[model samples]
Target: MSKVTLAIGGMSCASCALSIEAEVKKIDGVLESSVNYATETAYFEISDDKLLDVIKSKVQSLGFSTSDELHTPTEKTSGENYLVKFYISIALSLLLFSLAMWPLMGWPNREVNWFIQLVLCLPIWAWIGLKFQKSLVRFFLTGKSNMNTLIGLGTTAAFVYSAIITVFNDASVSFGLTQKVYFEAVGFIISFVYLGNYFEERAKRKTKEALNSLFKLSSKKALVEIDSKFVEVDIDEVQKGSVLRVKPGEKFPVDGKILRGSSLIDESMITGEPVPLLKSSDDLVYSGTINGDSVIEYIATKVGKDTFLSQIIAFVEQAQGSRPKIQQFADRISSIFTPVVIAISVLTFICWFFLGPEPFWGNAISNMIAVLVIACPCALGLATPTAVVVATGRASLKGILIGGGEIIERSEKIDTIIFDKTGTITEGRPSVVEALFNNDEETTLMDIASIEQFSEHPLSNAIVKYSQDRKIPLSEPDSFEIVKGKGIIASIDEREYVIGNKLLLEESSIEFQQNLTPNEIGSYVFVACNGVHCATLVVGDKIKSTSKSVIDELKFLGIETWMITGDNEIVAEYVAKELGIEHFVANALPLEKSSYVESLQAKGKNVAMIGDGVNDAPALAKANVSMAMGTGADVAMNASDVTLVKGDLSKAIDFLKLSHGTMKIIKQNLFLSMVYNSLLIPIAAGVLVIFDGPMMPPVLASIAMGLSSISVVSNSLRIKTII
Candidate 1:
């Protein structure tokens, strides 16, 4: 199957997205389709290449357009032209409204004055409201309906009825008609609607600013070595394997490996680590990370879209476009809203016409226009998705990657958080803090290093690194073999050597002469040579400084924290105490960790599992929400709901805070929308007309509807300012 992502245009709400998705799914050979209203894009997979055109045509039939070209994150929309139209429409609308109120000020020529109002209203409706008119025409042609259809029907009713009265001049006196024309209503309807749309577009642009900021991190040009001479060239022109010269404080143009000089690189933006990392020959340097004081030459490993930064941008875009379950309900409501609104408007007109009003036709038409104008479902459709888009974009800027908006809801309900010990609470790497020997210290260290050098385990590498750092010589180990779950065994200088955990030495019958007491917290690695007890190496994995603060904050938030690890009880207890965690499980395997999370969930707690993302995959999957370190294995990241880019435990707190803030904003938006609709729909239907109260005019109803939608969008943008 082949996948294609298209940037869709002219989508007004969640219902529009749903309609396009349903139509696209009907296409032959379409495997799957996901349409996102927030990002205004559709991602689809198809079994056949020939189905793309058919799919695009189907989307077009639903009053939408699609493009394959990927736009830059900062690319401006067609808002300028809309703004110009709104300015002119508002100016003309105010002028017409003033003239309509002229008779109230005792102005003369009231008979000929209606004609001038009609002339002024004509340009406002025909010229300014032409976009809605065209959209309405398209609906009739394609049998598809949207927000534009609502605006078109509402505005047309007022304009058409007023035009009829303007043409039949004598009817004003003969039938005792209410000489009030709805020209002002038509003017304000289009003008207010246009202003609301302009403001909405501006807010939507700000939501995407986070993605644009990511794009700005990349350097446009790179200094590449060509024929032994350095030449400045476009980033794309520098192919893989090309040597790039990066100066101090300059951003690396592509993912590369150092070829010559070493430097301290600041990858804080990408990784969220504030400290610059030391780099040397053969170390990987990513695109967009700045080189420090030393100049360096590096070989480009990946360029263009395949680079790490490009992948992050793509991931962020895909995430911002994702729909949470709340959006599904919003779409369902909006889908059936239009037809019901039309039915209500017709019923409202019938009730008003046959009931008590003297100027029955005029009153009935005015009330009908009011119902249509006030019943726009734009706010309902925008309530959830607009908030989600802004929240996701803001999270991405903070080096937090949320896979879907659904995660935000999950994070809110998390009452208990389970963290994997190694690499999660403590640094994954263990180092030798001290060594205890029963024989020659140098010989025992050399023998242990020789045996460990043949193995690639974390502890083994730490041992070899310690030996090398201490300037000790090592001999090669022969016939190396791994003792599953224990450690490694090898023949060094024709002597049998064993190096691993406590279990390895115990099983090998190497009796300890005396119990070794570690002065500090660490994992103990035992070394045995020739079946005789040799030495005990104390290897300690340093606890992250932020882990304690994160746990403390979680406690303050009324959340329980627990640590799960495969380490011995002593090490686990020590680390847990140091971090001030009250609960922990020692010697838990990966499956056991998952089971522990499940048991907590079974007890009616919402559990959030935090892990390095590899060994903790099972538990992560079983939790209510999973957070993975970006520096961890890809499998872990794939299984996680949220990824903390810098691998900082503190960010997990920020994630929960952001989730709570976003949900709060979404609830407020939904509340405003429901309240607006419930209160106004009855007023627009002329329910108060029986009390001799003023009948709602279409112009005032249109203004209210416009304000309601703009209010919802403005509230969503507030998520960006959330701490």
Candidate 2:
């Protein structure tokens, strides 16, 4: 399948996004599609790559704009200024309102005052309200409605009804018509809705501040070394394998490996670690990281869009554009909201006209306009996407890359968390703290190191490093077979040898002397030669300092924690106890780890798994939510839902806390919108008028509608501060 993301424009509410998504999905080859109103982007997948232009054209036909350059900030049209129009509309609205109320103020010439109100209200309705008028026209032509439709209908009704009363003033009185004209209501509704949209737009921009900050981190120029001479060039001009020079306090222009010199590098932008790390020759450096007070030369390994910083930006953009499950529920309601509201307005007009008090024609028209103005779908549409965008952006800043809103939803409900011991709860780097031998020590060390040199396991690297540090001579094994989750079997110099955990040795029927086994809290590797018990090597990895605190926090939150590892019972038990994890499973194979997660899930537990190796992939995929340490294997990160870039165990707590906080903000936004619409829609429809309560006027209804949407957007922005 092929995918495309288009930056969408002119979306007034969630219904606009839903309408575009619905139309885009009707195209052949389009498999899936989502349009995020908060992020103003559309994401879609297709069976064929050629469907790209077709989808864009389809969106244009629906009266919305699309851009293929999804990451670039959208610029406002050159001549479009809603704020300028708002100033004009509000000035005219205030003057018109005064003129319409002149007779009530005991002023003379009510007929002349009505004509003056008409001239003031015309410009506000026809000129300032042109955008909504166009949307209303599109609704008739295309049969799709949005927030603008309601605004257009409400203002037009009041404008036309008042214009008739003013033109036929004497005839209307003889026909028992009310002498009042609602030109002020027309002007105020347009002015207030414009003001609300202005604030909403400003608040929406704040939600993307994190993303904009990331864009600012990119280096624009690089000093490249050409023929032994440094030359300044555009960052995009620097190619992979080109040597580059970074001066003191300069940002690395591209991802590269240091070829000469050393420096203290600040990688806080990429890893969220505040401290600068010392780097020497042969250390890999990423683009957008600040170099400390030293000159360094490096060979660029990644450039342009392939840089580490670029990938993080892409990840953040994708996550922000994704819709969470709760947002889907909100979208469903918003899709039909405008049409249902129009139906209710019609019903309200018919009821009020037949049964309302004296001046029934006036009451019917006023209540109908009020209903149309007050039922805002914009608030309901914005409730969830805005929160998701802010939450995901904040998470990216903390070095946590959440996949999308779906992951955030899943994380909020996680009750049980299972962690892979190595590279997760403990420092994956192991070394030979102590080695015991039952036979010839030199020969055993040589054989084990030689066989382990062919293995890529963390334990194998530890043993290899130990032998190299001691200057111990080593030889390659002639033939070898790796036992998954256990050890390795090899033929060294025509001698059969086994090196692995106790289970591998015992399964091979090679019994070792129990008294020779070390009682230390570390992994034990038993060695057998020629079917005879030979030696035991103890490898130890330190528990991460943050592991205990994270575990404690999880327990305090009433979440169950468990540790699972392939390491022997001794090491697993020790790490589990040290970290205060009450439950653990040791001697688990890769599949066995997945089975344990499955068992928990079968018991109705919402489980989360954190791991950092290829062996941990199955279990990571099986859990309700999975976190991968960025310092671990690529396979593990690919299988997980959240990636902690610095591999800090504390980030796990950050993820859970962020999830809970984000969901809380979303719920608050939803409740605010739902309650505003439910309470006011009835009042606008004159439901309270039957009990002698005051009816909601169109001017007040427009104000309430605007505030409802502004409140939702403003509430979503609070997530950046709260989370």
Top candidate (TM-score): 1
For each candidate in turn, the TM-score is: 0.56, 0.54
Total clashes in model 1, counting residue pairs 3 or more apart in sequence or in different chains: 1
Report the Cα lDDT for residue 14, model 2: 67
Clashing pairs in 1: 613-636
Model 1, runs deviating above 4 Å:
48-65, 73-97, 171-179, 187-192, 222-234, 237-243, 327-332, 347-723
| RMSD (Å) of each candidate, 1 decimal | 11.9, 13.2
Clashing pairs in 2: none
Worst 10 residues of 2 by lDDT: 71-80
